[model samples]
Target: MAISCSFFLFMVFTMMDHHVGGHENVCEELRCGGKGPAIRFPFRLSHTRQPDHCSFPGFTLSCTDSNQTLLELPISVKLFVEEIDYISQVIQLSDPNHCFPIELRRLNLSSSPFQFLFHEQDYYPRGYGLFNCSQSTDQRNGIFRISCLSGPTHQVYALDLNDGQSLMELPISSCTKMYNIPYVPEMGDANILHLNWSTPDCRHCEQRGENCRILKNNNSTDESKTECFPRQRNHAKGRTSTKLEIVGAILGSFLLVLLVFAIYRVYRYDKVEKENQAKIEMFLEDYRNLKPSRYTYSDIRRITNEFADKLGQGAYGTVFKGKLSNEIYVAVKILNTSKGKGEEFLNEVGTMGTIHHVNVVRLVGFCADGFRRALVYEFLSNNSLDKFISSADVKNQFLGWDKLQDIAIGIAKGIEYLHQGCDQRILHFDIKPHNILLDQNFNPKISDFGLAKLCSKDQSAVSMTTARGTMGYIAPEVFSRNFGNVTYKVDVYSFGMLLLEMVGGRKNTEVTKENISQVYFPEWIYNCLEQKEDFRVFVEDDGDAHIAKKLAVVGLWCIQWHPLKRPSMKVAVQMLEGGDNLIMPPNPFATTATTRTNARIPAMDFRQELQVIPESE
Candidate 1:
């Protein structure tokens, strides 16, 4: 009976070894068109060519009917596989049809396991950023134009990714920027894109010029381990490799019995936290070399004195008056965001770090200790421009017409700097009276960049999915693309609304039911200008009236319903300086022209001649 049992066990063991070996043969390397790279373990063919457990997560590839391998990435990006170096765990991709450039606007590799691979000839380590500009935009040195994305309407360009700079520093003005892009990929080969995987890394095997194979599978954890293996032509006949696999299986089973399911849960939780942390740390790393000082949460408490003097509150965060020292005071805004990777927080830090203008608020420092984020700003004693411009009752506090004109120029210059002074363009989507702070001398400083966006100067128009800025101050194009594809004109429109509020000394949205007919300044102001009537606000002399009218005309030009009719900030600043041949802009309120008692304005929607006459002419 013992002899019979031993013989039976020997037969069972032989059958089990053959069964496992046959399964490994089934998952053997596959190729496309008989010339493509070998796709084996850690990368399996899609559509049931192999089991899901055979490949690492996010490593599935498909074979096209044309006998080519296709890789679909996050954000609907697709690339044709050119080659795969299994040893190095690197993949080479190409775009023969040139469709990759358009897909780049939607490409984000964060969800994928692969990252861009750098070449020896590549100038920028991370990747090149994309910018779509109009054909009229002047060309720049060291920048390459991507013709595949270019059309009669606009052209696309790529900028090098420097250590601490962005495409917004592109030094070409009058390029007529449109939409913004956020792409990071290797350059030097216009037709090729290279990416590398970290998981299942075969560095040891690669250094030794040998193949690596997944030998052990932790069934409960769904994990696998890769090890270097000697080159073998006949894998099934390799008894040494088979013996190693048997030993690995025995060890894997022993480890599986000792590990609990809860360990996996902890691993998954830790993985998610690490991913989130990696994203925040990556953003901070980009801005690390910038001038703004990084602070700890403990330092924030010491500076604010435990949130002692609250200055104000808004959608983004709350501001507190704090002292950097006895002589220097600062306004610290504790961001009201639990998401450290929030768009608002990143925007404030990213855009403000590079900006330095007299009329723009300074970023003193920032706090990013354990997700507790805060932005320290230069304190202005006079509060915001809204405090003085909101009501007309404060006679002593009101800035005179001359002072207001100077402030307007200062504001215009600031906007001009944001538009043209920087190498790239930065749009303040939430430009309003409240965002303009007042220094002790009442000089205006642009603040609140929670809604800011940075882009190349030469790109084309943008179509925003959501509206930005205060309701009354938001550009018409922001709400609807019918106002023309939204772009920098949105800022021009917000600037117009701000200028009108400055002249009227009231909010555009402060109308109540009791004063509905008597109030509503925008329409009322338009009527006064058309009917040759004096404004209700007090004016000292003819110069005040002239200054008010000039501001109104520039404001009117900026608030045009059609974006093409609005002046660029550069042109608006010149208009404010009284040199440009200014004209009363065709009324944007033409939809209400038929109901008015006396009105004369053209109803022409000049889409064909889509160009702003103010800045360009």
Candidate 2:
């Protein structure tokens, strides 16, 4: 009876092995046309291949009657597949209908796993051309009258004319069609657009002699991501690789179980064995070279006197007064454990550990004991610059225009040090009056490295996942990649906002008595400067007035909408130091800087909410 059962099972296994082998053989084979290039794996011939054999929905290739391979995209646009390079993972596609240029704007691949293949050598800058206008206006000096579609009644407005302005200001009032064409629109026949796409990303796996197979099925999309596994080696003629793999896997599992049992016994001997060996390696890697004194949870309590003297509180953490020695005073900030990824603690330690400057705040030590984390810093005598600034009142606490100018220069110098002085360029994403601490002599020092990012000095931009810094002080580029990538200029923009705040003696956002929101502080200040208004800053003499104007002009220059428009921190320092002769910058508040009149914010109450202590701890 046992012999008969074994024979029956052997027959079933043989049949299954044969079927799998046939499928593998078919998958490895390439499909080709009479004249077209051969395609395989990611690209499958829909007629010759089974639905389960294809990797993705959009990757299927169809052969035409004339032997041309056609690729129909998700957008219902069909293109002739000229070439496919599996090595580079690129598919060359050209519109079958040569008359109509592919609407590049509408060619979105957000849902697909492909990206536009843009090459610098073959790239061409394009501009919009408004054509077939019913009415022709007087702004038609460079507007060419297109006689192809219609007679002289149709005018084609090109961006090449009139200082490269947008189609938003098009003179043709009744334009029927607007299309974005190559800058040199005369070269009609040479208008082949190239796009590159990447997906399945299995080139490396193929290089390692591995086969890619779908692990999970996406029932809704009818496609799924592919995973790679090593190809099974054949053992003999009749005996299949599947049976050998199963027997070997069983033996390996038994050995693994025995090894794990031994390790468990050893681990039990030392109960405090590393919770996660991988996480320990990562922790060591992140803090390899950085030297900050790590403190225990008890040490934090001892330093803060059991949370006795509270200096200030914020959304993230609370600052407390801690004494290191008889003469040494340090500000201890205990972070809320449940809030963030604990990146703020890492940022302050890693960034501030390497720097030493008067204008920039100093980092003394840090504590990262389990979840209880705290940061210690040299406490300033005067808390922050926010207490000194108020639009409604500044009579007794007026620092005078000259003094304020000194403070601005000091702050600028600190930022310059952070940018130019450090081995790596450090960007203080949060740069506002609240973050700027003052000394007894009223010298401004930049504090709060929690939101700071460090990048190479030569690096043009720093990549960020989410926007950092206060909402009012955030640069436009930080919020949207359309503005530009986040760079050191982000700090410059924030500084510009801060400088304007200092000059205006008010928060940037305000709610009017009539419930209609007024212009932003920077806009209001820019208008005041443009019209040569007094700015209402307490100006005792000509020097004070000159100082205020200088601050305002530099402030305006720093807050230019585009990153390239704003000067570098080095140049900004020069401008701040170079007295009286600074040129008035152009209006930075272009059409993009729109006012939100409906936003009802209690500006004074908000400012008062974050008011750091005026006196030292």
Candidate 3:
């Protein structure tokens, strides 16, 4: 028995010794490639290594085909890492595209783990502007122009965006699209930019031959702080001191207890993760016949570079720019965990996988690893339609009226296809300008199936427990059952609102500086059509006038006060494509505020009463 006890003690001591040696070895050895500064600690190679091997999350590096190390930034930027100074915690970066001026105007480090080397450069308090010009200007205007990128027909200029003199010389009207960014010049190579990062100041302490340790918060008074001290300063003087031996044993025992606790916690975490994974698997079993690929959580993080470049954010999740391959880029939307029963995630994957229309965004893949969920979509260069029309200076960015008419026809066809073409009916509960994504050719595609519902094509009406849609575009029947049972006409109503916004060049319900009766844009258009006005906003000729009038007439017909009065999406498409004269319907809104309130209250009350009734047993 005595021999066995001593053997057990020896085994424990050996394990502790091996653990300490392993930690020291990890710090001493540097990870290196064929050339360049050896990377250690913070910066690690992602996918090729385990997360536990890295000191931090965002400090990951990837190797290029040419053996050069690359670091992707938060703004879809690719930077070649020229040098990494561990002592100073600075990384020297250069643009691989060799367009430093363009990069300087677009670089944003606010949400990143690093910042510009502020002390080395002449910092400008004002923001810089990147002007995309159609023709070169002979005037110097005190702005630094990128001559390498300039050509006879196209020129790019960089100047202080906020400078009154610069603005006067180069007005925004002259440029195609101007980009404003924080101005910070580089130190040595004008082409190279330097960024410094904040990390544990261990290099200085190690250089001074002192030991650094992370102090734990015992009473929760002080947060975790790194302290540097002499390794031998706290040593006991006497070799024969029994107190020292007792203290050593107690400390070693405490460490063993902590190690055991860590192992147990890891086991519990793995169990929970497995359970969640099972749930996701079971939920997606119904979609096995679908075409879209399923991705794991690690796959999602790798695809998005840890959510580095955010494209946009909506109520459900934030979208990030991702690349599946060198030639295939995708938009990965990481769904919020707060969503109920994963229905939204299921809806997006199910509805989009079956859809293959020119005007519908395609789903490339999806991630359903445990609680981490993400939907991958084909990347569209032109982004959403709202960006074009909502811009205050729309002349430069917005496509002309002829193109707008094409986009309207394309959208109407997409809606028509959704109602009639699909084997099972898909109700796009949300159909607004924001959801209408545009492609490179100014073609509009309807996106966002988070609120979409699937029903049989034979069913005329869809049952809903709650109102689903954006406030401005929701149909009246969706808000209240008294107007009518919810049908595909709801989408038609939303499409009509979208059409009016496209025609009027503003929102349908937005109060503008026009006459009080014309504050609502659709009402103003109705008054114009009623009076036989020329429909003069951006109408250069007779053809433009006819297209504008057609769009307005169709919009009014689809937004009638009652669901039965509104034309179906199929009929609406016909009016847009054919040369049939559209007769405007009755006004959807009341003339007085009191009358409007009275019209809305009774229907809203009926919906409330219907919502209270329980399902039949």
Candidate 4:
């Protein structure tokens, strides 16, 4: 019984030691305690800890060795955590030193991701000490230039660490020319620490109980301050010396303990990272079956040819121009890792994969390699509709009265197809000129089906919790149902805005003071028809006044405020093609504020309106 009890106690002690040693092993491997000040997470050593998430992955800390207690990140960036406010979710870090070959002073401010935490404070430059060096006087006394600029001028230097490297480089001449000294009292003689000095400061020497002396060089005019070396005290010979050695050992032991703890943290971080990669790979494998095709990161590099030519960027991704084969050109859209909407990518790919339409841009293929997701589409030479209509010079060349009418008709037909032609009704939440791409022949192709939603064909409109679509072009029903219940007619409202823009040769909302008072443009177009006046904003030699009147009438017919009153896309297409004598549209902006509020239209039953037929038929 005695032997068994002894063995059990030994096993328990061994288990305790093993657990404690596991943490110590990590600390020792990293050597974090010896490096510098140790900072741990719920904290990060750098601002960019991981791809998108703000805080460091695994909430690990870093330990570094410097005058400032710096935390070295896994990415090899060293940061000084000045303050951490848990309540505000803010961390203030000191400006990093620039030691690279590149003139890092400029790069520090612009390149570094660290942002200022203070609401209104601005960053400034670091100040240097200035001293008046004369041959007669000992080069010790000097003025510290703390606050130089007093008036309304901005603060040129900041004392807070949040300032970053805005003012990193101190002027070398500032030490001599400004006749100023640093606020730190231990910085011996200012002259020795000055740009021209060769020796150390004497005030530091005096603090160590050494005499201050001056060294003069034959070729140099400036005098350098030097300190007399101190003799070491022998503990065996004195009682005071013995006490100091014991105290030194105690401090050293404390530092050793901290160092061991730091190293353990780093070791644990490496192990965790490896485990995380393995789990991510397994998760991706499961997702791969659902994804159409798996492209390697190497394949992406080969396809993009090292991101040779960047097309443009948008909210979700960056576009790159690349050739898939000898004859085929494709636009590669690389999803930004910072955007946390991975589900949206899957939605767009899955939806577009099943869709094939002449007026819609085709998705050739896609790439899902780890965190790097991309989509490949057939390249459109003419870019987007915004390029042509938005430009003052280009709008006339590609978009004339004839072509604009054809484009408008084509767009309406396309939306009509999505509503009734497809197996499922696809609600394009965003409809604007920007989303409309043009082919080589100036044909409008609806692009960017990212915000699309698939609903039943029988439903007149799908209930939406959040409002979507571009401002100004959005239907009145979307903001308030006083206009009408939300339906696909919202698209008609946007189509109306686009039609008006095409007719006016510019955006209708962009009316200037020169034109605002003189019959609000859309209203003016309506009044002109009422009086049978010529409707022409731009009267060039090639312009057709009759065609302009037809487009204005069709645009007014589409934007009737109430979805019930607005024409369907099929009707809109017929109206665009129809000659004059189309029925007059009701005034859209005539509703009184009181009546609009009181008689608000309730939620729509999409089934009832889904059977709408073209009125022209």
Candidate 5:
């Protein structure tokens, strides 16, 4: 019994030393000068000086030879690091020459991890215009002059966005609009920029006067999560002799108790882990019954050439470009270990193994050797639909309006097949442009079945323990039953949003990085439908306009918030494959604000007035 206690004591001390060494080596705080702010975790000295684990991915700083600290943001100019308040997650930055108006004109922080410190209610910072006016111009309320940018007769000012003034409303008499500072909060000192991060959220911990650091876990590979504790950071230089002695005394006592508890916990944990491993093995054995050809882990390595050529990655796994034959290419998705124990692996394999549609991605093979799992799919050279869509961004318009119409039709047919052609009903809970892969010829193919749920054809609804889907595309019904039960219509709703994105140059709800005011894409299209306008997209001829109008109308019909007001995939396919005389869907957004359900629109819910789309909703 005495020997056991001593052995545990030895083990405990060794672990403590190891823990101290791990943090002490890489995350030591740095100083550019005696008065400079302490730089530590989430703000590394440099990649060459510190490991990535010691700091956040993009937050790297450099110390100048003259003892000045420089912090680079997305903008062209590098600002001097004035101070970093880890408590508030805010960083104070200043232009070297104190000419921020010139720097602010060129600054756009949307691409960077930082954002201007704005109130919670304010979704984002307001836009401001920069102008240089004559000294004789209308008297200004506040003077934020940019001396470097102004001449003897002119003074530069960044309009105070909080004052609710526009460029036209500005007293720009004898003033020239130099540039526009699209987004910034009103600061007391215009020369200083205060930017903050929402992540590495240490404010709560800091408010409690506890130190925040990466949450240490032996089991987890993810380092993104952080937690709070009493100061465990190892800055040997910062430690006082008395403080070190006190910490050592406390640890000497605390570690004895912790080690005893840890020994008992480990025994119990090992038993549970063994049981889990056995259960997983049983599940793998059952996977042998699946229809797709089973390949060993070795076969996967050979086929993928050890994952040499990379393709892309998504939520479930990383895809690598592979070659099965000299003539045939494949995309192999190696399932992420963090993805819950074999559930997503089983979901994709079981559903896709039985499917065969031109518009659906083909499952060439799969690998489930021991704990390793991978899925092989037919290679599509054109990549996912997301890259090809978004019109204004595409200079040449890779897929013309005619081709987009065809791709939309093909996607509709694929979804229609999933709903009706399959032996059992398969509801693909996720259907976004990213999941829609394009062939060499630009034919649409639906992929990624990890979120799909199976039900009997006769069943009216399937039970869901949790909502499963990409945000922005998830159906209203999935979030609230008040919208109705989860059904095939969920896919219809997502497809509607996808159609709208393709028609518009951007996402239906996407905001410009510069925060330019643009109407919502769906709302814009809805207004166009009501006004009998051509949607103002780049159009070559009347035929293109007709096709675009047809797609937009069908999309609006399919996205009626309530499942009861959404058309089935079968009806949607008809709408796409049909002629141009399709009547507009009833305004679905009218009653959204008042009541989601229980509000009737007098005989015009989901295509009752129109001959097509089948009043199924």
Candidate 6:
């Protein structure tokens, strides 16, 4: 039983070998005949039916029913395969263009898997040859050559199957002048035009006059047939040679597939790398042109001490204190990721990079590492101006009459610089006391340029859609502009409110019981001045009355209802510095609040009502 099983297994193995060997005869159908050349190996007839080794993945070849072949690439590219030579291993293709003249040339063998069969030792004794071709307007042609050292004599040639005459001919040397050759047996004589050389002795077998035969097959008649040939015959026998050829073809196909895959992967990797490099280059270009200091995320971590202490928080980011190597302190702001305000951050960085003024807060550096965005600013020890004036307790401690005036002037100068000093005029859309920071010397520096907008200096007024300034500080035209068009006077209005806050040592909207009737404090001050009543309550000291009056007049001038009526920061700075007590302002509350006549009549009516109550008593 064991011997029988072994015989059966041997028979099965023999049958399997016969089946495997028979698959090589599955000849591919050939379709040829066209004005152009027939498309062959290295490229298949269809993108889907291509040989596994012929094309790269995602890259395919298409042979149209009209006989034109096409190479499909990732990026849009169209090429027509004009000619292909199986013997010379070269292809000719034409570039389609309109204005540019189209020319035909040999396919770049180096770029493809095909190699020219050359005698290496004879053609290139040392190395390859490099050449240059120049075309002259005078129709002059230039030629240059390099000689081989020592080997068998060989000549450069190409196979032309299209002519149907000589199978071998010298290649038409037009533009290309560089080539490398390899050494082999009489490669020059074995051409399509002539077949004279004989096959050499088999390297593996020393048999004198051996022949090929089909050793095994399903049909006994086909298997019995065998043919022999002379040793001098150029071609080998059909069966044995076909088997070797099929095996070599399969191995070559695999190598071609691997080469194509490698090329595609390299191309894709390079393309992605280029795209990322382009993004980085674009960012760097903007940085270099804008002169913004870029910081890495790790640098930010060191500077902010891993975000140890928080200074404050806003809707979009948080501010942290950091110390630089110079021992100079800075406030680092880390922006929130969810907030879609990266454009605003970039604008602020771009604008601040070009601006350098004593009254403007300095931008120290910035970070834009993946997912992390931060801005570093020079630390202001005194913090925001709102800290001093908004809170009642801290107001008197920092903001004296003289100090307030100086701060007002400094802030005015800063706004003026933004409006005029820069190449482009900048508008602070959200100007308020909270946006102003004070230095060590109590000098008010305009901060938070995040909302600043750039406009051409030549333009008189900037067009705005939505109002951005603090509610109370926003200009009247910005809300109801039927009165007139809004302009830089918007900033003027905010500056006016800031000036009032400075002078009053408090916010203009005082919530005291005595001033409940006076909803608008500026109007209340106006009514007092109109009534010729003493406006001494707001005066901090009798000695500083002159300063007080100047501030009041300047504030009133800036708060004019119409944008055109309001003074520019340039003029306001002059007015504040000149220390001039100008004319009293018009009744700004006349349109909304009751007049002095009506107010007096109300008081008189109340008194009359009190007198009438006597009868009930």
> Which candidate has the top score in TM-score?
5
Model 4 scores a TM of: 0.46
Candidate 6, poorest ten consecutive residues by summed lDDT: 608-617
Give the winner by lDDT. Answer: 5
* Candidate 2 residue 323 C-alpha distance from true site, Å: 0.8
**Model 5: per-residue Cα lDDT over 1-617, one tens digit each:** 44676776677567655554554554666777655888877788863446677778668888777878898877567889989998888998878877676676677777787877766876766666667787534335433445566677767666656665444455667677767675443442456778899777778777887766788873687656788767555456445554566558657766776777688778788888899899879756753433667889998889889889989877778999888744479899999988788888988888999998999998988998888999988899999888777664465755788889999999999999998888887889889998999998999999999988887666647777689887667888888988777778889999998998888866544555564344245777887887887776767798878888888988888888777778788788888888557766667667655444534523234532211111111
* Of 1 and 3, the candidate ranking higher by lDDT: 1
In candidate 4, which residue ranges exceed 4 Å CA deviation?
1-294, 391-398, 508-521, 531-536, 540-543, 592-617
What is the TM-score of candidate 6? Answer: 0.47
Candidate 2 local lDDT, 1-617, one digit each (tens): 33544565566556655654555434443444556776666777776635545455567778888878887766776778778766677777665665323444255566665655644653443443546576664443334443333456565444333234445555545776666543322332333445455566667766776766565555655344666766555423334565566556555655665576667668675544565565668766653544566778788788888889999999779999987644567889999997789888888888899888889877778888888889988788889988887552467887777678788888898998988888988888999999888877888888998888877766647777788888667899988977776778889999998888888887754556663344366888888876888887777788878888888888888888777678777777788888557666656665543423423311111011111111111
What lDDT is reached at residue 316 by model 1?
Answer: 71
lDDT (tens digit, per residue) of candidate 4 on 1-617:
33554565566556544543343311111123345333422233333222212122333444444435443433454455444433233444443542111111122222222332322432443333333222122222222222222124322221222323322333323323322211211122111110111123344654565333344243566533332445333422453454466556655655665566568667787888889888879856743343334456676677788889898999889989887644567778898878756855776686677666777777777888878888877788888887677643463454676777777877888888877787777767667788788889988888777767777666666565567777657887778856656677888888887777676656544445676553245676777776887654554643466677778877887777677777777777777777566666665555567335634432221123444322110
lDDT of 6 by residue, 1-617 (tens): 33554565566556545745554332222343434554432234563443453322332446656666654332343455555543343444433431001111222333333333334443432122222223211111121122121123422232222333332122335224434322111222211111111112121222433432223243664422333333334222555575576557655655665676668768788788899899879865753453557899999989889999798998779999998765779999998888865865876687888887889888878899988899988899888988787743453465667887898899999999998999987878777888899989999888887767777666646566676666667778777767456566678888987877665555654456786654367776665656755554435566566776778778877887766667778888988999564666555567645444444422111011111011100
Better of 3 and 4 by TM-score: 3
Q: Candidate 2 deviates by what RMSD?
A: 24.6
Lowest lDDT 10-mer window, candidate 2?
A: 601-610
The models' CA-based lDDT, in order, is 0.74, 0.69, 0.72, 0.57, 0.76, 0.59
**Sort by lDDT, best first: what order?**
5, 1, 3, 2, 6, 4
How well does each candidate superpose onto the true structure, as a TM-score?
Answer: 0.49, 0.48, 0.49, 0.46, 0.49, 0.47
- Of 3 and 6, the candidate ahead on TM-score is 3
- Residue runs of model 1 more than 4 Å from their true location after superposition: 1-290, 338-341, 511-520, 579-581, 592-617
Cα error of candidate 3 at position 429, Å = 0.9
Model 6 misplaced stretches (Cα beyond 4 Å):
1-290, 391-398, 508-519, 532-540, 592-617
Tell me which of candidates 4 and 6 scores higher on lDDT. 6
